[model samples]
Target: MRIATYNVNGVNGRLPVLLRWLAETRPDIVCLQELKAPSEKFPAQAIADAGYEAIWHGQKSWNGVAILSRVGTPVETRRGLPDDPDPSQSRYLEAAVAGVLVGGLYLPNGNPRPGPKFDYKLAWFDAFIAHAAELLASGAPVILAGDYNVMPTELDVYKPERWTDDALFAPEVRARYASLRAQGWTDALRHLHPGETIYTFFDYFRNAYARNAGLRIDHLLLSPALAGRLTGAGVDREARGWDKTSDHAPTWIELSEQAPRTRSASGSRPSRAAKPA
Candidate 1:
């Protein structure tokens, strides 16, 4: 079974690219971030026509997320983070698909630090950490996949020194990501190919893809229950060069066929998140 995550940037504007990738790769399940469309605007019919079932939480022209499954109905378990510091942005979604509990998130791209946006990012991280701990304790097979936004280590960034002060590479954000790792969640790509120079995102500017200058911000972290089954992981780097494609290509993990079929822990609801309050 293969599971993938993508930061599509814009669902409507990139539908063709999205459909093409879906057709070509045919991952068993897909978690999509940056839908940038409201709930009513989600192209449900089109997605269904592509042989998948979807559940999404969307916000107008901003953060949004969804889960697509071809292997089973994506029975939604949660959507918004409980007590999210900002419940107005559509940043998180969770569901039980093909026997795995999947949590898809689009962490904030807090650009400049020492400001409100940066503070909000940290707060959101805190909430996510708390929620993740609960998920960990559930003892169910789980895969938390999406564009986490923050590049956790020097290995994850093209040039570490150049990103020192950027919110995505700042010490605080990296530490939060480390916390996730310490909690026993395995970063699938790095775990499988430990010294490899792998990247999931290339800048739309400066010929980044051509130069192989990119960031590995998109991830598929497996909970302890699902870690051992991970067999392969990779970035569809060539997709970044496709026309009208997102800066992010699909990042995925392949699991052994003997996956456990279990339900997910619940209680969060789906809602469009707004600006940080």
Candidate 2:
């Protein structure tokens, strides 16, 4: 099965680009973030027409998340992180699609560090971590996919020195991200291309895409139960170059029907993907 994640920025404004990419790639499941629309204006019919059944949590003019599946209708699991610090914000959405529990999230963009927003970001991360532990304990095949709004390491940033003070790259945020990964969730893309300078998001301005100045913030983390089935992963960099596209591209992982007896570290390969753009 192929699963992908993309931060749409604004579902309504980016519908055309979203549909085009969906049609071209046709992933079995997709996790979308930053819908920036309300529950009533999600354009469900439009998405349905594109051959996907979706479940979404939306808020007005801000954060939102959704899971779309073409293989089967996603069975609703959770709407938001258990005890979300800011339940008012539509950030996390979880569902079961194609036999995998998919968790989609739009983590808070804790900008302007040393403020309530940043504090809330950490609190939310803690809540997510606690809930994730429960999920891991369940021993089910789970894939946590979305825009994490964090650069786990210096390697994930194009110019690490330039973003030291930024909330997304702040030491505290990175530490939390590392701790989450340490809990046994596999960072699928990094597992396939460990040393590659891969990025999933680029700033919309400053000609970031043209210069390949990007960050690998969006991710698809596989639970231990499904990690061995990972066979391929990559970022659809070309999608970012499309007309009026999102700054975030589609990041994906392909999983085999069953786990192998022994998975090789160098066995997985990336699918068709463009150079950083």
TM-score for each predicted model, relative to the true structure: 0.92, 0.97
What value does the lDDT take at residue 240 in candidate 1?
Answer: 82
**Candidate 1: segments with Cα more than 4 A from true spot:** 259-277
Q: How many residue pairs clash in each candidate?
A: 5, 0
lDDT of 1 by residue, 151-263 (tens): 88898888889998899999999999999889989998777666667788889899888888888899889998888777677777777889989999898887876643532
List pairs with backbone clashes in candidate 1: 87-273, 88-273, 88-274, 89-273, 89-274
Residue range 157-182, candidate 2, lDDT tens digits: 99899998899999999999999998
Candidate 1: lDDT of 131?
A: 94
Worst 10 residues of 1 by lDDT: 268-277
Give residue 271's error in model 1 in angstroms: 38
lDDT of each: 0.87, 0.91
Q: How many residue-pair clashes does candidate 2 contain?
A: 0
Off by over 4 Å in 2: 273-277
Count of clashes in candidate 1? 5
